[model samples]
Target: MKSQMLPTIFIMTLALSVCGVYSGKVLVFPIDGSHWINMNILIKELYSRGHTVTVFRSSGSWYIKESSPHYNSITVEDVAGGFDEDFLKMLISRIIQIQADGKSSWKRLQVEWELMKLGPVMTQMEINVLAKLLDDHKLMQSLRDAKYDLVLADPVGASGGIIAHYLNLPLVFNVRWTVHSEGHFAIAPSPMSYVPMPMFELADKMSFLERVSNVFFFAFYEFQAQFLIRPLWATFTNKYFGPDVDYFQLIQGADIWLMRVDFVFEFPRPTMPNVVYMGGFQCKPAKPLPQDLEDFVQSSGEHGVVIMSLGTLVSELPRRVVEEMAAAFAQLPQKVIMRYTGEKPSTLGNNTLLVEWLPQNDLLGHSKTRAFVAHGGTNGVQEAIYHGVPILGVPLMFDQPDNLSRMRAKGAAKVMDIFSVNRDTFLQALQEVLHEPFYRENMQRLSRLHRDQPMQPLDRALFWIEFVMRNKGAAHLRTESYKMPWYSYHSVDVILFLLAVLATFMASFVFGIKFLCTKVCCKHKSKLE
Candidate 1:
């Protein structure tokens, strides 16, 4: 009896040790500060659940690397060094070129459009290069040596996905936007519009002309990707590393895709098994507002305050636009805090304070804050809606314009053009937004809808992650899509075949009737004679 008891105790001790070892390694890749915040929240949640997490990020990212003894940071180089200057010049030139060419320069215009679309893809490629660089720097080698059980990555960072692919670890792709009906994923509202495209908005609902236009669009992207972007990535990889690498393969192998959009913000649609919506995961009440911000809000009193931020990507606004905004804010009765990274414009009035950085979530959560002036970034838009704050969106590019348009259409927000924005227009928009109770009501309604979930978004996301891990790839969830060819998938060949068969049948029937009529006419003529 004593020997049997000793054996059971030893087995229990071994099991505990194995569980502890399994919980000690999770590798995360965060490309930007927002991603850092998001991943940090997730890591903290996992840590509380008894899992260890390490983050790999660029040095420029704002997350405090040394804060936690458990947290380890691996730095990557800034490949886009001084790129802001070049990017600004290029943007101006492209805008001018688009205006000058109009519809006449279709080919060149298409090229320019493709280049714009390729922005995110190119950024990912650069990240992939950076990942390989990190690999050489001994970070990836250490991770491999450590034998991490999972590799969680932001979709924007190529290294995370690439390393996961190479290491044959479970890979989770985190998306920060809504998924589209066309199977393409959008990170934010396509600077095109805001009201989410419903599931009914599929290719079948389009007119014949619209379908044709879509064909052309798809063809253009395919051409650009195959000829330009793919080649560029291949060349970079080959030159940097050796000939053993396959650039395209790295993109195809994510085990699971996680999205940061909620059903309230986006329409419900049939999604691939691997795609999971995890939006609003990091949206929780944080610490109190800074003393200075608190004092400023108190100073505003009954009139309340408006918080403005254009997001990190477009931190530097055009000087003219800034001046116009300053003039507009000067007339507004509400106190305004604008987050601007550039030099403080001399034209800003007493009502407006230009700060280099402000805690956005804290500001939004403030009782005195009534409205948001934003770029309609996914995070910003969601945060505004979550906090029940009305918005005035000055969308600049990509999904921002689309997002703002949707918000405006929903009567929850107003849209202002970035290029031609001025004092009068800004003032009127502000007045309408501040005075209108409907906007706040609508925002609150959305906030309620967003929160009416069966499970917290973070929990749901984590469950899916563990589900995939436990199920050994979650193959049961995958659509039979991998089995079909492109033509079959689109049903183009089926349509073409049916059209051919119908055409043949019609031609044969028409010819047979014509021959019969001719014979009857001859017989009738002979009988008459």
Candidate 2:
């Protein structure tokens, strides 16, 4: 009876606290495909908590039309054509082509940066699609009539900002990338002392060379954003929002920023009032695995199971690498369930099970699951950490190297370069992570920290969302530093002014001393004569 009464009382109290503060009409614009799940969890939770939610997203997004009564998903095609699909197909092709040419990680990094240099081209493509949406007379009318409480947008692309401006709504950015430069610039101080740039794969601590690379990469990011791509974003903004609007200034209109990063998995850094961390925010209880998968895991005996997946970004690994991993799995005692989108490279070993896709969270949650082999994507890494599963990270591109570096630094994972993957090396990595107690212990610690938040991420997000609605965009939360120019915000201008003053004073004193010394010497000479 006491247990029953306690839960009942808790529920009632929670309900009362959320009455007016948790419900509002929210417009969500998140990146489609793999990144969608991050915000999808928040959206579902919001709807369950009685918020009227509208999502402007891709047609192929996970959210279907019949998912909920409180939600309305506006497909990108209803306004613009099916550009998301086209973009993703192009992206995949480019990645595959680059992988073919890039024989080493350094070469791959250069290829990725080369793609980043095509920012203007990408920006123009986004602006073209979004412009069509804005020009849709009926869609614009409906959006204006909706009287949305707030706009939620992903900062990866410029379309969200343009849409938010067109609707005359307050904007909030949801960043899937842990170290998004633009998102960091929008909300608060991202000092180089702690903040890392994405272009260079850097961790929190840096040697002299790493720091030099960090600064250089930051200059590169600035070049892409300001000099190379700024003109494209500027043209779009001017064409739509008027010539008076500067892209940088327009981007600063974001009221709040929610980053899917936490101190547990990342290096601890200072964050602003408007900046919120939601790492492992997408983690939820796993549903039951299929009977087939369950049987496979249970059949592994006392050796446990290992899950290997490269995530959605990589459709398939190179056939040679796939065959090598398969051979390594054959030599292991543990049963492995791997996600493979391509044909089997070689005859499958009795210890391995190949599936097109598996319920990743469900597999991770299983007690029999002892290890993970992945490409070190943030979501995959976070999920592995959430489940307390040690990982053998085979990083390929983007933030994968940095994520794996941090994982290795934290003692939760081992990293093997994709280029260096042979049967011997792969098997050695697997043996180390599975047999080592330190790796499992570190993973367990990470899991505990990720879940030990004061309030759940969903509730925190809802609280801020409704807080913005109730306060008419929560302008109070915006830091004053957002208004400061780059030089003033970083104190570069003040430092220069102080240096100039000191130089002037020193010059004046030196002149005075020289003049007095000459006069004294002349007077002494005259007296001697």
Candidate 3:
């Protein structure tokens, strides 16, 4: 038996070795911070699969490192400043302050305006980087010479799509958001009647008033994209590409969009063929925790532990909010582990442990973890769903509220407005999630459903990426509707033409009947005479 097994093992090993040799070179343009976390997972996977990876990072990148064993880094010097931690922290604080003014229309607009300010800044930064990259003759020549197989990018910024177009490389997007709108809105048919726009925090099912609001929100974003955002990229687009080139069109024309979400987390809506769902692709079974953390988990005993983290961008909340949260955590019987960089809250209990960083995935996967208190980032929410941990969400900004809304709709989470959250309210929400069996049960069921797929989300994403590279592009899968003008794509012209033909036929028939009647009447009159 041993001799027979050795031969089989050798055969299998040889086959695996042969298969691994067919690797392609991938050029990555990733967004910094939490977005980088998702992109980095793919890069690591590609590296493990024996593919060569090269990362393009701005000189002032926040989270993206200059050195990584998984990929080579090409730093874009003096191009433009990438999003750093301090800038994000300040933005978050301002948004929070604005939100405290209540939910009146004027207040909402104020918040929107605050958020809208980022559009020009980020767009301009990306355009500057694109221009700088293109202007450098040596760099451009080297890029062309290297002949990368494809460009994998997060399209929150347009630089990647523009560069991909410039190089004529096959493009794959690791996307949730695009420069203009949500990823689906960029390519898929999103009927505003049901498909809620991002930031609205509405669910798939909506009331009549909600639908109206959805439409209004849709229009607002459309206006922002067209009038405000699109024009910023025009000068660069015209200079490098042609004047006829549309920047948004280049984004829509990507070969594949590896959307970082799945049906489990996303509302049921129309999606494109090339749009692959890879929700929780960064998730994996938790490894053993660090010894100190393990001791804490062991100390929880039967009561279990509650873990909290606001993700990479905004670790520290306002001092008052932190105090409120700390007070709430103090009331819980379960031990708490929270990630905070702010001053330690005076109300904080001995049961709660504050750390500068926590291993979120490992903590969530622990059997002792009772619930998660989070700010409703996609990565954190998906991880909770993946690990079967229910969430108590304090959605701060951006898609956070919307994400929490989905979880709440699914009965896997309970959410409260961060501005409205007090010690009592926070404790109540947390207690409900901790005490309710349905929360855990629903999340576990979702976890099972998410896990029951034939292949891992990451594996699916990798296969499609390789599929694109092997074929030079996934043009067959991508819809050519993006290339068509709006009237043509929507078939408005065809509908009008059909209507005109029908009208012509009707008019001809009426005229013919009238002429025949007139002739018959005249003949009758002549016979009578």
Per residue, candidate 3 scores C-alpha lDDT tens digits across 136-245 of: 99998898999999999998988888889889999999999998778999899998888999887898889999999999999888888888887888877878778998
| Candidate 1 lDDT tens digits, 1-529 | 9988998999999999877643546788665544566777777877776677777655444543745755766666556451233444466445534533222346345545755565545455465546456458475577678877778877554566666766778777666521112223321212112222321122223555655555565455556556656665566567656666655445345667777776566644445657788777777775698888888888998999999998765556667778888889998788999999876777798989889888998889888898999988778887887788899888655456656665665668987666666789888988888998988888888888878889988899888776665655655655554345669966899999999999999999999999999999999999999
Q: What are the models' TM-scores?
A: 0.74, 0.89, 0.95
- Which digits, one per residue and each the tens of the lDDT, describe model 2 over residues 1-529? 8988998999999988877454678888777666676777777777887888897765544423425565787765533344455566566656656665436767667676767755666566667667777778898899889888888877777666667777778887778442126356456556675567653557778787777777787777777677777787777777777887766564567777777877888776667777777777777677788998898999999999999998875677667778888999999999999898888868469999998888998899998999999888888898888889999998766667778888888989998766557899888889999998999999999899888879987677767766777777756777666567779987999999999999999998999999999999999999999
Error at 16, model 3, angstroms? 8.4
User: How much is the lDDT of residue 305 in candidate 2?
Assistant: 95
Native-referenced Cα lDDT, model 1: 0.68
> Model 1 reaches what TM-score against the true structure?
0.74
Index of the highest-lDDT prediction: 3
Model 2 whole-model lDDT (C-alpha atoms): 0.76
Q: Candidate 1, which segments miss by more than 4 Å at Cα? A: 1-24, 57-70, 75-144, 177-219, 232-253, 480-483, 493-529
At residue 384, what lDDT does model 2 achieve?
Answer: 89
- Residue 227, candidate 3: how far off, in angstroms? 0.8
Candidate 1, residue 5: how far the Cα is off, in Å:
22
Per TM-score, the best of the predicted structures is: 3
